[model samples]
Target: MDVMQRMERLVEQLNQYNYHYYTLDQPLISDKEYDALYDQLTALETEAGMALPDSPTNRVGGELLKGFKPHRHLSSLWSLDKAQNEEHLLNWNNRALKLIADYNSKNPDSPLPAPTYVVELKFDGLTLNLTYSDGQLVQAATRGNGTVGEGILAQVKTIKSVPLSIPYRDGTIEVQGEGIMNLSVLAKYNETAVEPLKNARNAAAGALRNLNPRTTAERKLSAFFYNVGYSDGISFADHREMMEFLKDNRFKVNPYVTYFDSFDGVMQELHSISDNRSSLDYLIDGAVIKITDMRTREVLGYTDKFPRWAVAFKFEAEETTTVLESVSWNVGRTGKITPLAKVEAVELAGVTVQNCTLNNAGDIERKNLKFALGSRVFIRRSNDVIPEILGKVTDEQDGEEIIVPEHCPACGFPLEQRGAHLFCNNRLECKPQIVARITHFASRDAMDIETFSEKTAEQLYDEVNVHEPSDLYTLTYEDLIKLERFGEKKANNLLDAIEQSKGRDLASFLFALGIPNTGKSTTKVLAEHFRDLTAVMSATEEELTVLPDIGGIVAESIVSFFADPFMQASIQKMLSLGVEAKAPEKSSAPVTDSFFSGKTVVLTGTLHRLSRDEATERLEALGAKVTGSVSKKTDLVIAGEKAGSKLAKARELGIPVMENEEEWIKLLDGEQN
Candidate 1:
């Protein structure tokens, strides 16, 4: 077959596979077989110097748009009128029936019948409007103000479930759907995600609006079409018929859609959805009941903001009344103090809720919450996780008002408010703060001290003289055996882990120092730039800020940390305890013809050809300063699979990108830009 024919065949096959796997929840081919086909198609398309717009390769990503253009929708996407209870649903139904009757009386020849409702799950996600012209996807937009929205065609094209080209090829059609992040996808994503998304709705919204389509692809967002915003080629007798048409056209329609002859049937279905909501893969905040017949819907038209033909039956919030026993301040690893409310145990969503997050002092004050001892409060458990206090339940101010702590709970140091949070100024001196720092220093990501635990750190702090990172090196087996649960094996293993940690590389050692704003990636950048701990400690804020990935705030924090006499003393003590902080030796490759010579490069995402360590070494060997972030000063960015914010920023700044391992290796071998 010719190249174009082969491409056409591949696109059709891939679309079928996607439909089966993502839409139908069944796979006809193994993942390995599918990948082989995909690779073959990609190579053919690249060699042919042409690619169809509907090719599956588009799912990988697209060139970043300069900015989202404003798109005026063909029809205004009206919001649903909400019904919180059976009474509300009945009232709406009664009003809708009366409207239909009035229309029937006015037009005697064409009488509108009593409205039958079409019930569907109300997916808790961002609303999207997809426009198709002649069966090919043309424009995709968000629901900004019902009438207009930002175009997000590139990002939407990355969703595997969203058909790039449909079977119907007649005229322009607009389909409305909810772009949802599956609960399972969110859970898997949060497993390795740096910042876990709060909920599926937020994740879906964030992915849809992301500047880079690559980021959106990584999110694995799905869409479920329910409404027809506008259509020219097709006509449907009812909402159910339109939904069936959407499903037949390869659009994902909600499977739970059912016809309800009466308000009682609609209420039953609404309750059923609410009861089993936790078992569903996607989030649904409510159930929507719409008039079944197209003619009846027209007769009972729309209000100012909502459709009169439909009403969203909102599920009652999962909340319960509980008594606030006491409020306590807990210092986190970063020394930021957060308020924890000890509430009287209450069952919410089949789980016993005790402590609830107060968020911050501002949240408590804004809620006008009396965090006084033994006050009645309402606690809600949303998404079946960490419960939160909604507000005070009683008007009586029967207990003492909760006050922000003046001193750290773990140590006696004075607390200072930084923006909305309160932080302990004493970094190394506080007991809990010191233990947390030491525990983090020995964490596997930092120093790879596998045997170290927070419990051990606390024990050592209270019983032994272990107060800082340096104190950990001073711990002896004799001192450990004196603790309550310490035995010979455990103590020996912990000591061995500590000894091994002392020999960690400069990057790990830098991270182990518990420097504020310096994560593992930042540590790697700092180590590559300065080459040693001494250089980093002596560097001024201006010098540090100029280095790759080091911003003004981080530089200031670094300088301030090193300039402190206590931090200096701690470092000196650690060095005296035989801790060897050494930078990795450079490669012997000559740097004269290197493309990376004197360039600052940031590496984001996962490289297939080399591990992150190996890639960093290669870049540094060629006189490049490898960094963790992309900034305007960055000369190049080597982006690989699943690259996120850094890649977006690099493209936004018009920084050059090395897309794959081959390009990166070529550049390392002195290939010209």
Candidate 2:
């Protein structure tokens, strides 16, 4: 076949495989076969220098957008009215019955019967609207403000469960659904995530809003179509029929839906759902009870913000009352002191809860949680493994006050207070701090030293006299073999791992240094900008601050770290031991000036296309000074996914903002306003 014909055939076959595997829950082709075809198609598209709009390659993501464009929804996606208690639900039912009775009285000859309700699980996730034209998936948006939403077609296309094209052709059809990350998916993601998501709802929301479709694809999100927002040349007699049609057209419909003629039957299903919620794969905050008949729904209509035809019966928070036995202070890897509340053992969310995180000293003060011994307190557990103290339940104030430690609990070093956090300043001598530093150095994101554990660090610290990061390089296999459970083979393996880590990239080495206020991203910026260790060591605070995302605080911290005699000695020792800190090669592209010329730019959040280091290099090449924090001095801010405090602060300071990769590229090419 010719290239165009071959490409067309591959698209059809790949999409068919996707449908069978994702929508039908069956695979007609082996993964290897599918991948081979996909690779061929991608190669053909690249060679042609053009790609079909609906090509399966788009699922891997194409060009990063500057920002999401506003899409006015064809039909308003109204929220469901809520009810908390059984009494409130009954009251709502009574109102609905009364409305039906009034309708019957108005039309005496054609009397309306009591409305049968369709009950479905109210999935705790981000609401999405998918529009299909001529059986092809076209537009997908978030339910931003009911009338208007942000277009997220590319991200939505990544969801395999959502059909790229449906069987029905002609006219636009809008399907409203909940975009959710199953609990299993969330658990799997958390196993590798640096920061575990609080809950599945947040995880789903974050994934859907992510700038990169590849990220959304990696998240393995699912969608359940619950309602039809708009449909042309088709109609359903009831909600159940509509859901059936959606399922037939390759859209996922909620499996746990039932029809009820009375409120009592609906209540029974709600009770059953509540009892089995823990066993479910997805998070459901509540149960939605809606009038089943389409004609009945029209008669009920909607309020300003909510539909009168449906009511969400919200479930009570998962909380239990427990006694606060005592409080314990624990030191973390960063030497930050955290308060752990030793609560009386109680069962919460299918787990036995004894200790709860009090966060920090500020949290205790803000919550006014009098850590009075034997005081009754309410504890709540969300999707996180750790439980948190909600509030005190009793008025028993006759107990000892919890005190913040002035010294480190482990090393007895004086604790230094910075903002709301307290840290141990003894980085060199403190045993726990030293071990944490070593563990962090060997962590996956840093040096990626395999088989290095906290236990290993502790053993090395006590037995091998490994006080500093550089000391690890000096250890002989004989030194490790002396430790318990350390055979000759194990010792050699560990020594080999350590040797391998010595050749890690400069960014990794910089992060392994554990410089205060310098994270992985910041370390990348430093490595890319400074080029070499010596340059970084000799850099002034002013010079450091001029780099992207290196604010005054980080600049000062880097300067102080290099200036410290102990740190300087450690770096020199590592260098002498043949630790190679290779700098990133400079880009070959010539420098150009547009808006970024001599501008003070700050970047925040996760970028879709460029790493923080690459973005910094691009800005710097254009004579831009990339700073960390937002201030009046900041000329521009490049905001990306989850751009939080810095983005807000930039707006407060009236700084111009570029929200995505496309805008940054356009500005660099002198093509943007």
Candidate 3:
């Protein structure tokens, strides 16, 4: 098929997939298969130099806009009157019934029916108005002054459930919905976000209002349509019919819409929605009740600020302003200090909150909390998350400044500034650092040292001078048996665990070493790249940065660590005490079970074409055990540039060796061929 035809077909398929997955919650295709199709379409578009008008790729705005334009809405988006209590709700019902009675009395022969109510969730998000023209999405805006709003068409396009085009092509229509970030999506984003969003409401509103459309796309927003604000050629008989019309046109109408025949039923549904809102994926501040009959709404409508037909039954508020009485610093496993705010006890979202996180020192400055101590600050508590300090109530510097600590709060060591954080570098003398390092080393993903705990690390540090991880290898019955409440079996078990830890694979050993700015995935990549502990330790930053996942910061951390004399001595001592850190063997590497099989090989210096790791891998693939040193039992040695003492010793021991790069590679290559 031609490129344009192919692109059109792909866009239609992907949009249908998106509708099923996002709106209907029923995925028609697996993620991998969908991605493959998407990739093919993206390549074709790139090849053709243009994307189809309805392409899913339009979700990302090609460029940032300077500012939002004012959107003059076709129909004014009216606000709903709020009912804070059952009495206020009853008053609203009485007013609606009275209006209907007056209209019926005037028309005597044709009377309005008793009002049935349509109840829906009042979503706690920014109100969005979307306009569609001739089957295609044309504009999106925020509800600004009821009649005029700020255009956010690019931002709204990022919402996958908002169809770029609809089935209705005869005329234009405007649909109203709430733009929101799902609670689960917000939680997941916060898990890895550098600056976590304080709450879902602000996160959604701020993203949609942002000048950069990329920000909106990254937030993964969703929307639920409830009203057709303006329609040129279509009309509904009732609220249910309007909702059905919205759904038929592919709008994501909220499924919580319920019809209640009586005011008591509406009240019950309101109570039920408020009670069960905590279980919902999105946040809702209340439930809304609207007159179901279109004719009844027409007769009772037209208030200055709110429609007489609908009222929002608001639940309790979740945010409050509180006095920031004090601030305290707490240290974590990585020696990074975090600020915790002590606020005046305030009940919020069903809990009394006294403490909230200030995130970090930079965050304190960014939030203008440096001078907010003993001042009123805005705080919010979501249902399950810890309460957060949003900001100071005002920009006025009316209170004491929160001082940044120059020394570690726990160990009194000098603190060093790194990026937005302060770190304590006294790894040897700091109590928390030592304790945490030991505890992390014994973690399941690390060395798997059984019966080890932070309490045990603290006790060991206090009783014996176990300042470094290597010190664990030296513990004995004499050391452990003297500790308080230490039984014979306990000491033996501890020693056995320490002994067993020596055999942990290279990746786990690297992770147990606790290099800063590195994670398990990074250590695993390092193990795969270097394949030998000595090679990894000796890897230069230039070499390290070339490997996958090894960025400048992590490479620098690894280099700086191994270059330290104390750290070097500790690792050497561990090896001397019989720690055997080796790479995990790959079973799929081509195995040449020939001459190199059952042979002990020694690799010294570095080949110009291949790294020491490469040579070691080939030797191991050929069934050779690559050792670090030359000895009488060593059968062969492959030496490269600046071959030193190990190479000389191999010559002295009369061990067969290949010193030329060409001959060495040829011999290894011949066996594999």
Candidate 4:
């Protein structure tokens, strides 16, 4: 088919699949087949020398914005200080332990028990700022210098990782999210770039700051929404549950993220992630451990830049002593040449350590590094994660210069030498890039086709000529039977899935498009709020920022997604194939005053008459704002059995305190009778 006809056909196919997988939560095609078609379109667009206004490739990366616009935060966005070293971390842990111990000791009559800590990955990326108006996405910015930040709503939209809308029943709310790059994608991008990145964190940071948003669109930056800044209607008793609620709202939260039951468990989890960091697809600089209960956090209170209830354990690089047998060069997706060190097999963290990587030639020259086929080197891992040779030279040894590759190892392409690095010019045809891109297209956050394994995708890319997501529709049972062990039933089932997936919603389709910065939750929010795929594809800056979770960055991504020809064609093709893309209904309520409407209510002690959920629900239903613990800002404190600090604080603050459930009920009922 000619370029236009090819484009027309591709758009019809992609649109249908987009509706099925995203809207219906069901898919028909294998990831491999979809990827092949997507790749073909991308290739065709590149060759046509024409740009479509709406294309998936356009949302990949973004431009570095000018200086921040100095937007004030509704609540001060605070930065957490790293627990300087192991000793400091231990001290902080002990302090928390002692605080609980002392509290129990002082209140012998009815002591409070210590609760467990929740630990999570401290992602290395830009802190995204989002504002919501009546539970809709409205504004987004970056944490520029903490207090003031630039508006990046347009730029942020390009990132598929961030949500375009929030899931809350409130008038206004602000949230904080983190933008990050995964190791797998980073590895792939670096393999294709002229200068391969040293790490995912650096790459993510760089991608967020690109001068041209169009350039930024190529990096595939991802992010996770974590915090609620301001709230009007919704209430969360526990911090962990709040996260769960965010997930329920279709926000793409971190799955590896977990909460703990105790201090020991939290510490163990921290250590475990550190040990297994190399295996993780994303880069983490430290562990963010917090009190799972919101009340506990409120009771603990805040320091200058951090909450006293939370702490971060930043791990140092992991170093191992090993004998280096030999060194060899390898080509990456971006064509950058890297050196690999063959190490003697040694057991480390359950797995036998066989090979460690050396970043570039500069690293070799820095340590006066040499590979005499047998040399000793200390291998250092990132965040105690990935194994890499830091340097070498045992006391009694002669030195030798490290041998570097003169050509690409994978394709025999001529290597271009640069400062401290070498690169290959084989861009699209590169094996690593092809495999990685195809795999990425078929990933769960993308088309979401079930039972499509990476191994199967690899076979399609290598054995079959499949290169994009839409290509799956072109395949037949005959195509599958040709492969080893391919049966009629399996092939038909795969085709059925691909066919059914044509009706996915817009966000999933956008996510499946693999737009940079766009991740799971962002897609969901966009899909829900925009109503139709075309609206998002054609959304302006003002329009995107009007949504809850969508920020400058995410807005930009949406704009870019629609700006690209390939992505647009994909949408059209899916639509032609009878794909239906529509958003879920939004809940709306009138602003009528209820009992708790204007009252600031604080609960203290334990209530026998009502559970926390019941109490909060009634208060919220009545329009009352229930805050955690008791403070000077408290309007009224409802005291139950054995009220402690909150009661004392209420009295000290001269705030009115309700003695029992009867008194609280009386106030709610507005009855002296």
The numbered model that scores best in lDDT is 3
* Over 4 Å off, model 3: 47-49, 190-196, 328-340, 347-353, 357-372, 383-386, 391-673
Winning model by TM-score: 3
Q: List per-prediction Cα lDDT, in the order shown.
A: 0.82, 0.82, 0.86, 0.67
Estimate the lDDT of model 2: 0.82
486 in model 3: Cα distance from truth in Å? Answer: 27
Residue pairs in clash, model 1? none
Global Cα RMSD, each model: 17.5, 20.8, 18.6, 22.1
Can you give the lDDT of residue 453 in candidate 3? 88
Report the lDDT tens digits of candidate 2 across residue range 56-127: 887767666678899999999998788988898998888888988999889988776668988888888999
Clashes of each: 0, 1, 0, 118
Better-scoring candidate (TM-score), 3 or 4: 3
Clashes of 1: 0
Clashing residue pairs, backbone N/CA/C < 3 A, model 2:
548-626
Q: Write the per-residue lDDT of candidate 4 for residues 1-673, one digit (tens) a residue.
A: 7897787577557645543443222466877888888898788888887634334444444445575455777777877757856677677767766776677788788554467776667777788888778554566778887777767665666665554444464587777888777777876775556555555665677766665676666777777777776677677888777877776654556545666676667666666666556545565667787777676566666777787777877765344567777777876534677888788886654456788877787666555464434676766465334577645545444545567767677778788987778888774466765565556655665656666776777787777777655566567777887887668777777777776666665666777766656667677767777777767778897887888777898788778768978657766766776656545455345224554567788886668878875787577656677887654456788877655445645764568888878877865566212
lDDT (0-100) at residue 84 of candidate 2?
A: 84
The ten-residue window of minimal lDDT in model 4 covers: 17-26
Off by over 4 Å in 1: 318-673
Per-residue alpha-carbon lDDT of model 1 for 419-442, expressed as tens digits? Answer: 768999787677778788889888
